[model samples]
Target: MYGRGGWARRIERRLAWSDSFVIVVVMVGAHAARFGWDPLAAVAGPSATPYWQVSVSVAVLWALQLGWARSREPRVLGHGPKEFQRVLIASWRTFAIVAIVGFLTQWQISRGYLLFALPLGAVVLVVYRAAWRKLIHAQRDRGDLLAQVLVAGPARTSEQMIRRLQRNRRAGYNVIGACVPGGSRARKTPLLEGVRVAGSLEDTAEVAMSLGAEYVLLSGSDAMSLREARQLGWELEGTGIGLIVAPALVDVAGPRVSMTPVEGLPLIHVEAPQFTGSQRVAKEIFDRASALAFLFVGGIPMLVIAAAIRLSSPGPALFRQVRVGRDHQLFTMYKFRSMYVDAEERLALLAGQSDGNGVLFKMHDDPRVTRIGRVLRRFSLDELPQLLNVLKGDMSMVGPRPPLPREVEQWDERVSRRQLVKPGVTGLWQVSGRSDLSWDEAVRLDLYYTENWSLASDAVIVLRTLGAIFFGRGAY
Candidate 1:
């Protein structure tokens, strides 16, 4: 076990060191290409040091850059672009320092070399970091270099966390088991499925040491006081085990979280959700312009699709279904007829064989779907008519996914929160897994958007949706 742990640690260090080294190598290469081998030879002619000395100086400068950035620290890895940002800052800082020193000392350094090297360093570092991250994720999926965590929480929260982690295995958390605070319950739940009970809160340390847990996660509502938590931390100190506290706040975005220290107490503040006034105006303008442009530029494609539907199937080219929108208002959602006109009539007959969630009916290979319809649905061409809905002020450029009236009727109370703003043609759900998502997961994404809508976020979702549609992920 110790050998395996040491190997994981070594791999972590190598990834960081190699990334910094590769960045420096590219920077030096770009500098050499921009300015010839003897850039300073004009001023220091015949008295210049050997070429190897110049290479050694560049290597020293690169090492200094890595030290200044602290890129080797493990705290900033695996998430966020902060690590990349720091590397860029360090590279630029090195260039500026060198340039200033050279100018002050009247040393003849090549401006051409410095200019090319800085950008080259940035591009190379970004590319290398992305490639390495892909490799790490691939290995993680195979259960390599993952953290074995023991959850210390209520049975319900622990069960939910385990299920979520299991569903997204690439996240790299292997939940070994749970340590319920009040001991196990008689009524069996999925909580203890394939997991041994390690003991209650008082025996946390014993369980941790025995199970060889690398990390311990405390659920927010678990029965542990601040003092008790501190004691637990002290006990686990110097054990190479990590402690994570799960906050009670759910579906909140990073931008919405603010930590303030007042009188030596840290308090977390959550901002209210608002997508109105200037934001609403901006969304409206965006929708109107995009809708108009698509309608005009895409007129030919729309007409051709209409003709194909008419030829392949004997029905109107367009299909309209009632959908619930903002403020619980109803609007006619438009799409190309992917099924026969009597699709609704046929739905009842196929109800028992429905492959969709209990609330939504879907079939992977429904006989009602025509050849042209399947093609259109694959690339999401059928969703084009909804652009008109956006132009009509019935929808925004981006919001929660639009829901059918029947689906809306089955939604939980919190689901109605999505109706606080107009529905959209694409949303977080569409960009995420779309139809592949469980009903609960879909609702969670929609609620997250509703409770934390931002103009920047909307723009990002739209861009991601474009890529998702082209790739046809989670689309039948």
Candidate 2:
């Protein structure tokens, strides 16, 4: 019922207000800390510009930089890394400009003030943006604050797009209708379960208008020619409807894509994925060092867990299993035993009752789990010992899930891509849905991570894993 432009404007206004508030807080706090309550008097500086004047100027400049940077634009709003990156760039540019001006004009700005304010303001702005994004995600989850879209493409492509949009609700797209190659005759056969067939490609604009669509998404298989696509764009020019062409590339991040115009045609160039470099070496060192630090920090609790497991079950406190690591190498992965001594013996009887994906056996309430073991598994205490595996260089702090030897043995060419990176104590699969995910979904996420691994993304997954563990959402 809400207009897309109106919703976007509302979010933009809120962001603007929050940005101004953060800027004011950072500037005023820095001023007060450096120069105390006196506004008229300048601290020991060559220039005698009033502290209040300087604060006001800095705040206004910061807000202007944010606006000029298009940080609040709808395209980068709600989700993706672009929003944060823009905010950071804007903040750094503002500071750099101020530094240059101060240097040239011989205006003595307090070094302590600049140092304290710049980093504090940037961090506060990013935090505020993240909080706002969380609120937007919650609204989108409830089917609010989403852009209505009409999918125009072949039946297969439309269906795939709908499924993908459904999977990522935070992307803020609500598919309202579909316009395939066929006309109304194809309406009898729905493209997606809820998405209605509006009309053919020729009637896309009309269909989008009727459905109040903000955007028309053209999938890869859409039969519209270049001229026809251009005509469609022209028709929607005055209607405030945007056209988007969905490329065939899957699991490609924006950073790896570039657009170049050649002979009046926009050509998309995708960079090949890189796994080995200085970054990989740094990641390897980081994984082992962090693991060593965690082991030292959690040593006492691990010992207590081991003692509890030994007392609860007859088997050894620690459980060692063969797992496939990077390059298909085999390694002994350790975990605090969270199952009874006879758990393996009883697996055959419960195999048919597995409540997990076909490839991974899991149960919400398994009889093999001891009382103490259940507590340990619930909070992921069982995974604490994997820090040792990470320290031993056989695993990482974040990567694809460490697969059992049996699972690796059954891997096809597609699933084998996970072996390109070292197994991890936590990963996209762990934070996403864990035991609740289907085999294909799990594999898809793992491959996505494997293909587009970055230190920033790894840090994000590690943080989300903590939240998932605390909430105990999809854990067995």
Candidate 3:
């Protein structure tokens, strides 16, 4: 297969060049025909002012603005709002320059011409981009526009990179094969299905060239020397191929990755994960403001839930459990009781029937779950009390998963690091797969968040959490 990104970049450059030419010609023609040329001739007679010069200047400036805004950046071409933003920026910058020139020279610029030209150019640009994006998206829908990437790294890292690319197709990567730097001892050419081992890391560049790969994705901690890697970049520099570096750090959220150039080396600094701090302060402020507003708004529903629980079961409406929080502090986490009062007492009998992963106990259909409790858990009404906990600073709107002391005690050294920040009512695990996640996977996600938290990441998690709660996947 062809290398990843090669085809995509080629298409982007072709479209950009063609579109740029068209936009420039149309802008120049529109402005001169609509306003400048006739008026300049009317004022200057046959002597003629330099109208063509001004028109050419405007066209050139428009083109330069497009380039400056990187309206043609391959990575952002077919998705997100960045592409549109760039187009708008380019058009507005060109318009501003025109306005400035008219003011400075005291030129009789027609208001109708300026108004019509700006909007028309913007509309044409957006239309062309939208059409091109649609075409590219259609190609992706048919799995035709993908760039076949060659992943070079150790066996495991290569495998992980391949899987990650396969999972996120919108990123436009297609992992065709892998090259293990040290070479694998396996007799088979490929350790995984559909992935052939092209060569060792020492020959990574050669493999990429031979395969006509569009992109080279690098992984591994020690496969290639820095000198060899630099040489590989130099070899691929003019080859129209792209190089991507994938670090060994797994599950790192994007905002946490920051590059600081210390001397000549680009050192990556990962910030510690905390949902509170400034983000928490902001969240808390929102939560308190919201909770107070919601208590009045949601008070009726809260009362209804309480009444339903009281009438359905012969017990209190709320249940509080001892949960570990930030700094390993113990707090009583309140929730609408979803299990009978004797659920904990009955845990000993259900030991053999435990459905949870070793440490955490769960049963898909527990005998202790009250009828009303089942409904409460299904829609996550049980979590509403935690909003109060959030208001009180005992929990957050988003963070790592809160763990029980027993579960915390069973954690290995790395897992215990989750306590470095406050726990959340809803977190990465809650939004990811919830009860469906294995203990290991859940711990991994929570720790991943604990090690790389951000307000934006928290917002994304909370947004996803809302969807998960609505879908009720793995919630029971």
Best by lDDT: 2
**TM-scores, one per candidate:** 0.73, 0.89, 0.66
**Backbone clashes in model 2, listed as residue pairs:** none
TM-score of 3: 0.66
Kindly report which residue stretches of model 1 are placed more than 4 angstroms away from their true locations once superposed. 1-140, 182-190, 262-265, 285-307
- List model 2 lDDT by residue over 75-183, tens digit each: 6777666788788889999899888978776778888998878878898888788778778978989998888999888878888989989888788888988898875
Q: Top model by TM-score, which number?
A: 2
lDDT score for residue 235 of model 2 = 90
Error of 1 at 58 (Å): 14
Q: Roughly what TM-score does model 2 have, to 2 decimal places?
A: 0.89
Lowest summed-lDDT stretch of 10 residues in model 3? 39-48
1 against 3, candidate with superior lDDT = 3
Q: lDDT per residue, candidate 3, 170-235, as tens digits?
A: 566767778885554432386577788877777777778788788888877477878877888888
Task: Kindly give the stretch of ten consecutive residues in candidate 1 with the minimal lDDT sum.
Answer: 43-52
In the range 1-476, model 1's lDDT, one tens digit per residue, is 22136645676568657865785576557546855555443433244453335445655676567656865444444333455666677777777776675666566655665566666766576567656655766777787756788788776787777776677655556778778766544222345567656677767766877888888887654577777887888888988788887777767875678999897556789988875778778778888998899899998999999999999989999999998989999999888888888888888889888777677787889887888888998888998989889988888768888888888877778878889989988888887778788888888888888888776677667756776888798787
Q: How high is the CA lDDT of each candidate model? A: 0.74, 0.86, 0.77
Model 2: lDDT to the true structure: 0.86
In candidate 3, position 454 carries an lDDT of 65
